[model samples]
Target: MKELRSQAIVLRTMPLGEADKLVTMLTREAGKVKAVARGSRKTKSKFSALVEPLTLGSFLLHAGKTFYTFIQGELLKSYTGLQHDLERFVHAQYFCEICDRCLPEGEPAEAVFHLLLTALETLEVDPHPARVARCFELNLLEELGLKPALDACRICGKSGGPFRFDPLEGGLVCAECPRPASSFPVSAASLAVMKRLLAYGFQKLSVCLLSPQSQSEIHQVCLGLFQHIFDVRSLRSLQFLKAGKPS
Candidate 1:
């Protein structure tokens, strides 16, 4: 049997049989992996907490015919503070879910691994969780080769703003440029904020305060881009997030 040992982050977990769990994780060395954790469903199982989603840990596993079997794990980070906050926790889940959906299994994704780890670490203490999340999403999109051109109009190549974001066309469209029926108006302020979010580091994100209008615009743009590019109709975490909002 082949053994694999690496630092990994749990993406999600599901019950298997009666006492075991099917765990999905993103590892620094192996990208996304689905493994079975024996007896993890039992309260007395030592592996129970280690398999919780959003956890970072070092793990040992043995390859089976169909799946890898987790043998041991050492908790490296639990992000306890993040789990305590509902908004932050849901955002973190959204981040993981995106990675889980986008990345292929067994292919090494070191860049994405670091991006997610850094995002989680930043989300734990960052005053502006939304900025952190936006940055993470933009960076992740770039990593996946789906980055939208935000610098100028996708068609005209002009440097000025007051552009409309067309997710179907994958970039900004100026008034002079042929706009698609799917394109929607995006304010200059919101565009500037998105450019900054994509370029700035996580430590600097706390300084960018977003107005409610700009926030909604940015959210829709990202959501549209994600859905159009990945063919993902919706994210479960996003539904939970919307439901949690004050209506």
Candidate 2:
């Protein structure tokens, strides 16, 4: 059997036959892989914690006739901190699902993998899961070739200050060059923050702040895009977030 090594984050896990598991991972080298982890359910199994959801590590996968088998896995960060919080776990799950949906077959997505793991670490370390989620959504849009028009209006090439994300049109629309269906509400400040999220790196967003209403506006904009591009609702984590106040 041939062996392969790759960096991966556990997307999900399901029970296989007795004492085994089917582990689905989003790999940096391979787009995604579903492999069998033998005896992962055993109490003394070395892969017990290593094969759980949200694990980031390197794995040795044996290419078998039927399916890949886990040979040995090493954990880099188990993200144990986030596990204690329900909202955080929801965020991680939704983020991983978005990633698994966007990537194509046979496409090596190293950047996406790193972005995901780093974003999860960011959520684990930082107090802003919602902000991190926004950052991830904007970056994902760009990576999947659906980069929003933050610079200028899609209708006109004018570079300016204020704009709104028109989901139906699929980009930002400036005040002057508006489409008939450009009815979605967005404030100048809200658009600026979103533009920053898209144009700059994640670190740039660390010190930024927005009002309560502004945060909702940013989320709605990105959610609209997510629905359009991926045909899915906002992150499942977000539903829990919206139900109550963040701790």
Candidate 3:
């Protein structure tokens, strides 16, 4: 069997027989991989903590017929701060889940890998989890080649001012253009925020502010576009997030 080593972020883990675990991770070089971590469930297992979701580490594995077998792991960052807040934790999970769903196995996803690492770091320091989540979503869409057009109207190709986001048409429609049945009114402030979020890097998100109305608009538009593009009925972590909200 061939041995491989790479930097990876733990995405999820499932219990195996008694002491083993099925660990899924996104590797910087190898993209998504599912490996069997023998004895990882045991208290004394060196990989016990490193296999938790969102933990960044370097992993050594052996190729098997169907899955990779974990040999050893060197921990990098555990991202333990996420556990201190429920909202943050849920958002982190949502991020991981989306990555898990979007990435294909064994395909190099360097951009996505880096984006996820940066997003986790941002989540730990950024006060607004919603903003981080939205930014991450927009970046992910771009990385996946599903970025919606925001510069001009999707219909008339007109530039400037109060636009309506039409997920079905895959972008904004100007005020002068006829609104599609599925279009929703989008304010200039929300459009500006969306543009900035898509343009700025994660490090600059801490200072970016959004009004409550703008936040709702961006959320609705992104979520609608995601569902329309990916055909994902729902995300479990997002459901958990909505359930925990004050609404």
Candidate 4:
């Protein structure tokens, strides 16, 4: 059996039998992995602290014929501190759940793993958590070839001063598309901001000048697009966030 060590984020955990856990993790090298952690559920188990949801850690695994044994987890960052504030905790959870659900169907993209780490790290201090999340979703879409139409009409290839997102077309549709009225109406400014976000790297997020209104609009657009594509109402954390403000 081969041994592997890599950085990963805990996406979820479920109890198995007793004193054991089944963990789902998104790793830098493996994309996503499911492993068994023995005795982690017990009060005195050294592994309990390491298997938390959304915990970022480096893990050592012993690959077996059918599965891997989680030998150890060395914590890198645990954002649980933010959970003290209900809203921040909700937003973070929503962010993680979206990531866990929206990833592509194949080998894990290493770049995305790093991007997620950076965004989660930013949430620890950055004030514009919403902006960071919106940007991350857009980039994830682009990487997965699920990018929405922004600047141009997905149908007529119309050069954009205006266009509406027509998810049926998988992007904006031009007037040339029959019954373009069926498309969701999108404002020109919204298109511009969306374009800029996709055009720039995520690390450049802080440098942009965005008004409060613009930020909210971007958030709506992202949620709409993501929910439609993934077919989920929203992240579970979003509801918790709606119930309280970040501290």
Cα distance off (Å), candidate 3, residue 164: 1.3
lDDT of 1 at 164: 93
Give all candidate RMSDs, comma-separated: 1.9, 2.5, 1.8, 2.8
Q: Which model is ahead, 1 or 2, in terms of TM-score?
A: 1
**Residue-by-residue lDDT tens digits, candidate 2, 17-105:** 99999988888888677789999999999999999988888999987776689998999878756768777777887787787666764
After superposition, the stretches of candidate 1 with alpha carbons farther than 4 Å from their true spots are 231-233
- Winner on lDDT (1 vs 2): 1
**Per-model TM against the reference:** 0.92, 0.87, 0.93, 0.86
- TM-score (C-alpha) between model 1 and the true structure: 0.92
Ranking by lDDT: 3, 1, 2, 4
Q: Which residue pairs clash in candidate 3?
A: none
- Candidate lDDT (C-alpha), each: 0.85, 0.77, 0.86, 0.73
Model 3, backbone clash pairs (residues 3+ apart or across chains), number: 0
lDDT of 4: 0.73
- Top model by TM-score, which number? 3
**Which of the two, 2 or 3, has more lDDT?**
3
**Full-model lDDT, candidate 1:** 0.85
